[model samples]
Target: MDEDRIMESERHQIEQIRELDLEELQVEEVENLHGSSDDDTSGRAYRDEFTFDAGLASLHTYLGEVEDTHHRLSFLDSGAILNLPLFYLEGVVLFPEATLPLRVIQPNLIRSVERAMSLVDVPYTIGVVRIYRDSFDGRLRFASVGTTAEIRQYRRLEDGSMNVVTRGLQRFRVRRRWIDVDGAPCGEIQIIQEDLPLRIPRDAFGTLPPLTSVSSPGPSHPTMSNTSHIKRQKCREGKNDFDADSEDSFESELSLKEMRLHQSAVESCYGCDTIDESTSSDDEKNVFESGGSQDSVTVGRSSQSNYQRNTSDALGVGRKAISQQSSHKQEKTRMDWIIMRQTRSHGVPRAFWPFWVYRMHDSYCLARKAADMWKTIVRAPSMDGFTRKPDILSFYIASKIPVSESTRQELLEIDGISYRLRREIELLENFDRVRCKNCQTVIARRSDMLVMSSEGPLGAYVNPYGYVHEIMTLYKANGLALIGHPVDEYSWFPGYAWTIANCATCERQMGWLFTATNKKLKPKYFWGIRCSQVADDMR
Candidate 1:
């Protein structure tokens, strides 16, 4: 009887909707449909093992991975130039180590999947590019950079449609593209070579001299961490932060003048006199490989070349001399190894460069910071393994962090792990507001976000129309006016009925308000907002 009533009610609702005509329905019609003026559309935000507030937990899903699995999968050779099948999507940017689920309804789309599966040479892979509509001429546009999706799972629907779960394997730059006779898009792709972590070795830490006693009040330079400062001090001795504590050796006993003269002698012998402190890093040139509004990520060959160019003017001096100077600075100037490994000075080493080198720009250091920031924001899983491996952590966070599509696309185009992690740390720190991408209205705040799944607060879900929406669940939302009657059919969240939610200010449909069918269930209501429809208002 309950099922029958539900069926009859749904039929009546559909008839009413047809009568109202969705195109012409307005807020007044919505009010008439609900038949009530009462409005307490907000919900009791979620709570989970990770957080006391469901909104906070939901926010964690956006910060952390939606579906995390430890795998050792392989990819196509980075050195090779290969032609692969293409799967063009709208407003989607796939990152490496990320999962993309596709629901194919069209015949050509199904054939495209079939063709990809039939390939026996490599894996079932296809280049996924984002296609966007232009405003000026209403023409189609696509990005040059894209990710290769490897079909991890596939199934056929009873209606002859196909469903595929693909994992993004590698990032590629498309050299050329064309459509085949079978109507499948294809691309000639070259895999981008990603950089490894710039980590300080364990031996570097182990080989340093142990501190014993401070020598006759040496210059009080800064130390790395306070813990190192405490360990190296003979006693607490009224010291808390780091200090340049070295033993009472002959070098310390020498007059400051004599030491300077000796330093001059060493530089003269090496032909590195007056070496600019800035031009001495392993690769210390700034090479930006980017277009408008795009941030570049590199100091590779180009930087090495720039470094050589900067030093070429110093007739007899070369990289060997600078390396020696850098090593000398490491061995003589700094000693709080326990506090941390050191990077040198481009500036005061305070706000910009801690003691001046771009050492903080190292992938390993950035990894630690990014991980800590993530943990601090949403105290959930253990990221000890990621701290050791920066590359994996960098990609993992890039895939999960709920920012705008353009922001994520920028991450996909980035080449270096350190640069990527640095950008991610910035995003994670400033992640607060969710607003309308079109009108920039404040639709929700970070406190209202809820983690309904392991994937994180925001995730991709395909509608019955075959359009994929990256939706973030929230315990509550504001400035939203409910539209029409709530419908339960094909709802993303089970047992929750959905009604279109439009921005009350601009009347733009931003997302849907979900209300539970069973009154006994917690949250009684929630909201699922489209990530693409929202912007990150850092302000």
Candidate 2:
């Protein structure tokens, strides 16, 4: 009876994710539940295999080609000190490459939209700025950096209100602001330069030379012209074959010798034993086998990688060649590394979509940083992978991070993609120590953060009356007690009931938890913490 009871309890605790139900969730809502797929490399155990749609299917028609920079530039171009209608928002700041949805009902905003649509030179363009109320004066203040939003779609409602969707085009500084004759706020703005696109020179990389480059055939090695001719012929015919016997012999003898030379050279440089040949060979072999191919292979090194080859395996390498070969190898590695780092740090596209991004995306430091951040937010999952484009990933992080409005606004203003990501990563690392603002009592650890919504941990959810509620969600609370019975009405998580929870120590309202009433449903319960309530010391 006790074993059965324990099994029952375990079943109730296990959260079963329903992959099919993801289609019903909004893009932002989905982001709240799952961190960027980049968390897989974090080395955590909570690696939940999830597929997200991002709900961008509808925007296919409206998303302009990124390569057509001229098209977007035309819409955003403005001389310094030009006047434009403004749309003011509270608790929200838009970034370039992000999407914002708005409803125009107020007379001032409606006029602004109309005036924008009427403009011939720059139609459907408006300035979006965030308003913050000063604590001392209790007056609203606008941020300096605002984004230019281009209206992509619009609809007229029966009540004469306009429902419009806008995509952020460019970042601009608010040079000045004035109230228009029609009671709308207008701004004189200066366009900010978009960060330079990272581009790598394709010609700098040479095709893979024949694997025979490392053969120990004394001075009898084939010349470069002969090798090049054979490779070119194979490419033309598209029927290249490698005999297993030859490959096996090369691996056991030539490869081993090359590795020995590399290991010895490294040891000599650092004055310490760097790698053991037999042991390292087994591991390298396993990695090579799992990696599955030698063609198109590029080797990368890092300060943290367990092993690095000096690339000193030329044919007929003698005692005198070791120093010269090592020097050449070192120089080559340095140059290749510099090129790779330059390409990756800028997040430039090297090849075609998806595949190219994956091919060149190897920032070991960035990957390790992401992994550490994942450890703070959730306990088990390692960072799986991140989006190819840094800007897209930046917006996703801005939308999902469980930080206050001011913090998110600060993130929005950062022009550098890598800088923004690094800042968020820092926030994640420090946010682990969550404490009560009033008493400094620890409420929940970062691991307790559970993604309950599709929009991410923090999202701006509109209520029935169109009032937007920016919420930060968490999974479970350590120092909170449930106040009342679960309420079903207007609950965001479908099929679940919400109950208010408060801090046990201070008796202050913290957040709520949604519980599944259905016995068969997985994730019997999860918590949602208000971003406003929790104190993030990192801020």
Q: What is the C-alpha local distance difference test score of each model? A: 0.59, 0.52
Q: Per-residue alpha-carbon lDDT of model 1 for 1-539, expressed as tens digits? A: 12234334444554465565445434521222222222322322134322223333322222112232233347777756888889888767787767677778878778887887777665477789877656589677888889888876666778987667677888899899998888878889998887767643221223333222232322234344543544455355533223334322433433322333333332222221111332323323323221223211121232234434443354244334445454544334323221122221111111211212354455676787899887665443788898888998988888777677778778888888878998898888788877887778777666666666566666666555466667777766777787666776666666667777777777666777877787665566677887656764544
Candidate number achieving the greatest lDDT relative to the actual structure: 1
Q: What stretches of model 2 exceed 4 Å from their correct place? A: 1-83, 97-105, 114-122, 135-139, 150-167, 197-387, 435-441, 453-455, 478-491, 496-512, 515-522, 532-534
| Per-candidate RMSD, Å | 15.9, 16.0
Cα lDDT of model 2 by residue, 81-180, tens digit: 4667998776566766556666577788889989987777677789988886675896878899888888777766777766676777777889989988
Give TM-scores for every candidate, taking all chains together and pairing residue i with residue i.
Answer: 0.63, 0.52
Off by over 4 Å in 1: 1-73, 135-138, 200-356
